[model samples]
Target: MWSVVLLWLSCVPAGLQAAAVYRRDVPHQKVEVYSVTLDCTVTSRFAHTVMTSKALNKANSSQEIFFDVDLPKTAFITNFSMEIDGQLYVGNVKEKEKAKKQYDKAVSSGQTAGLVKASGRKMEKFSVSVNIAALSSVVFTLTYEELLQRKLGHYEILTRVKPQQLVQEFKIVVNIFEPQGLAFVEAEASFLTNDLLLLVDKTVTDKKAHISFTPTLEQQRTCPGCEGSIIDGDFIIKYDVKREKSLGEIQISNGYFVHFFAPPDLPRVPVNVVFVIDRSGSMSGIKMQQTKEALKAIFDDLHEEDHFALIIFDNKIIKWRKYLSKATQQNITAAQSFVKRIKDNGSTDVNSALQEAVKMLKNGHRKNTIPERSTDMIILLTDGNPNSGESSIPVIQKNIQAAIAGNMSLFCLGFGNDVDYSFLDVMARENLGLARRIFEGSDAGLQVQQLQSPLLLPGNLA
Candidate 1:
């Protein structure tokens, strides 16, 4: 009986040792890491790691203290659940999954795995997501493909993450596959809604190339009871650095266009013009000659559809035209002939000419009936003071007020020293136009250029 008992004890010790080894090898609940990748592009390529976790507690005891992971400062996270000690924590799990997928795909495709000497290119960074608690056994495997391309001859890959219907983030990673070299970098973004916020980060391992930046955004914000406000945001940017030739050239083209095109689209409203010229005695010499030349240029530049009329103020108000005409060859030639025939006459009646121009624009003759066209315009040019009908500046101003009530634009040009520039400036401001002074010795061509430059083209006319 004693011998049998000793044999049993020895076997018992062996059995206990086997059980301990089994427990050490087997986990109560497995933690597996799976990869998900996002395929798209982001504006800026900043280096950072993103962590994602999901846990399933099958124990009936409802135990807490499940998982913990460190997060990077510049990383974005969403759709993750956290349970500390005993309770479930609700956060953004969707965003977490999206971020995970982006990173995983980037890693598996060899796009973000560091440099590969065989291809003469290297994977600089990756976008990846970690999936835990999905499989019963702790197993890790890559699960996505990434599409990579060369932009302006530089290696770059884009990854997109859609966490919610209204929210999204893009990750653009550039692989400096070449040896250390200098590169230029720029970035921009356009969102469907105004409230979306964007974050951009860039880093260069080596310094060798010059960088230029041009950024633009077409932003629209909604207001209560008011129509949406459209704003164009543009920034001029430049940077220079040096590095290796192996990285090639990183050309990001989407961020390139806004540097050139945003400003011209904003606040460009059509202009209204009224030609008020002096056909008086003082303007008879080269002054009148230059005036006519300037007038012809103005006529030539007028949009075919713009609103304009000619009122030559001399001893009397000569209303040669009552409606704006296209700058067609025929109309311009006829207008030019009329301007040439304008001889130095008795006295200057500036007030009468202004009144008549305003009257013609306000009356809206048969030829001036385009729908939705902007305000009418009256361009006034003169070389002498009011010496005829309604010479009072106040009376001329009253006519101008009436024109404004009708929504007109008034521009004034004064030639020689005889005209009143102060009054011209007042008229221009009242009607949202410009007032300019042309000296006797000034180049008439230059004056013409200035006058014609501001007139809207036919395509620009509303």
Candidate 2:
């Protein structure tokens, strides 16, 4: 897990919620933020960074100050520390049981302590509070590392800023070094304005780039009245590198060498896709409509080089065609009509449905009807647990594994909160694929479009 675990004399008010930055300054909040800086260094595929925050308590009595930052869930926190009037305290790792006991003791006795938790899909929330002595200052420093993953085309690194009060010095610096060569660099921020664009400096060369965002106190204000800080969004940096066809870019340093190869402009690998959908009675009303809409859009995105099959299951499995059909216009139209006529009824038979889909793909590959160069994939979408035919998760997983034997990738989409997502996730991972949660909403269909993921275009590094 890419999580940051911190233990110290950290505490928060009983009812305070987790937040990256305060949206607005509270009247009794006497902590004054003087300076803040976040620096990121990226070398090829890995990134390491630190965040430093300095604040002073101005009230006559001690007050609580929080250090909150949001980071990608795929990042690792290496170190965390706090300095109070020159006395420093650092976090040390401990066994889970021991740590839990210590945390409970601190909280029960009304001593300072805090907890870390997830915030969103891509980001984890790291928050801690410490009581600052009156008229004294505190410094909080955090360091972390992550392996950058390229999506679509570029790699992105970002920081969330929610400093409720304007600081005299607020700066962010990102330095990236690519072994091949710098293709292009772009800087953006949710809170960036026309006038603030000048502060977003970008300097690029052959293999290195330095991007900075240094906004002044006046620029960070929400308005002339200064009711809240305007620096309340993400500061994101995106960039890519030049690539060679075969030899790629190999860099030797210290004693070891690394080779990075991402072949550019390669034709999309032809795929025989089996979309296994659930029409169990639970999938009625808007859920059914959204699934239909999503499927139609997906069919439209199919390429001539691809072949697809549609299978809908309730208690019994139904197929639109007896075999995998080319993504020609006629076949797509027929599939769409079959989907529009689908009605929700009967109990879920997830295990049998999956096994049947896998059987179809395996049979096609064996019959030589599907091209030898084409890949077979099962995109299974369901909103409920198995209720018929091998309902046991372990049995279903073992049976499917034996049937496919790693011959095809199985991607699972668990729709709505009612799904046992972990069950689906394990099945996908066991079969050379991944699982995704399709959130229940109007945009549910759009989420299905994410099927065109990094799995399609893989970059090799050694």
Candidate 3:
């Protein structure tokens, strides 16, 4: 199943006869967005919703109208639809290849329809564009689904708000119904201001919540005369549910059952981690320097109860030590120094690098130096696809999975624009871990440090 959610649906569809009602707010703008609404309903923490945005081309001639929205990266859009005036166009979603083919065929006549591209650190951009005759309106709707996972004892719902222009009527509403009873619920936005704060609302009962953020046209302006939108960041809702002490919570409904489990805090099990660093030529200047800084910060945060190893590689592998070293002050400093010495040279050998990292952990565990209860993982950082030494993606995935043998997790970080993010994403998924693309920027070090939020992967499941 794919992850999907409807973002806005506050405006009713009954009376949309006038293009004047759809105002973009910016005078002389070719298109007028009359209404924008996101309505999300969650039952037992499973959300079902859609976002609806309406725009009318008020120009004297045909003009290109675009509907753009940022979506959570984890959500998979299973179905998408667009209404151009009175014509309803429905599209099916399945395997990526098939779905893409359908999309290509729909707009084969050369008119634009939809485009989904990777956007931010945790969100993707879903865009739709159509050429509408003067006075015609367009309605865009997207459907996607994702199973929300608990992180740091709470579930978060994130929606990216980027309507491109100031909308006359804009609102987002989320309704949550939890049968087991809600522990707490809170909502906030990155663009919230004094006046916008008043528009944000949260009503939570033991078993339900109604959260909404509806800023008026005046409240969305940057200044008295500015027509630009102030709503261009993340809208987040965080909440959790009460859990029982047993095997978590299980509910039976309509002859089906769902088991939800996340036990309370348990004693920390020491982690055995191996840092697989890539120093290919592409990671020459800023990337290398930022990576070293990130590694130093990472060492500063390691728990003393944990053990770690370092493996830096391009075409060749270099080990920091013979085996895992305890995260003591002295060892962390030495590891930091080792990271600082990594320079850019040679071609990438991801396959060989990962194999050595896995072997080091497996060997340590076999030698009994690594505690049996400790969680083991490999964090592979690369800035480009392998251009040397077994560059085959499928072969690399197969070899790495076989070497790890489900005994540990593998999290991959792909850096820069040229990196093969999809390969890393698929590999990480197959290995019970996940992958994230680290955009190349001055804040790349902070991006690396932010990888700390990977939950349950290295935790002891109760």
TM-score of each: 0.40, 0.62, 0.65
The TM-score of candidate 2 is: 0.62
Clashing pairs in 2: 10-113
Residue 63, model 3: Cα distance from true site in angstroms: 7.3
Task: Look at candidate 2 and tell me the lDDT of residue 108.
Answer: 59
- Clashing residue pairs in all predictions, respectively, total 52, 1, 19
Q: Assess the local accuracy of residue 199 in candidate 2 as a C-alpha lDDT between 0 and 100.
A: 86
Writing each residue's lDDT as its tens digit, candidate 2 over 1-462 gives 222233645434343222222232344367888999999999986899999999999999877788777877667678888787887767654333455577666555655544445666577777777667679898988898987777778888978888778898999989999878888899999988898888899999999999998888888888876757888888888888876677677778898676667666666678788999899887776567767877886788777777888889998999888799999999889889999999999888988888888888878888988888877888887875888777888998888888889888888877754568898998898898888765443255455555554333322222
Q: How close is candidate 1 to the true structure, as a TM-score?
A: 0.40
User: Could you arrange the candidates by TM-score from highest to lowest?
Assistant: 3, 2, 1
**Per-candidate local distance difference test:** 0.44, 0.76, 0.74
User: How displaced is residue 313 in candidate 2, in Å?
Assistant: 1.6
RMSD from true fold, candidate 1: 30.1
Candidate 2 residue-wise lDDT at 8: 48
lDDT of 1 by residue, 1-462 (tens): 000000001111111111111012233332321221222222223222232332333444322212222221112232333222333333321222243353344334322111101111121111222222222211111112222222243333222222111101222233322222335544333332334333333454444222222112222223444323222222212322232323233444546321111123344444456688888887777678778867866766665545555777776776777565555677767877887888877787877777777666556643444335555667777754776777788777777667567476677777764457788888777776667766444455555554454444322211
Weakest 10 consecutive residues of candidate 3 by summed lDDT: 1-10
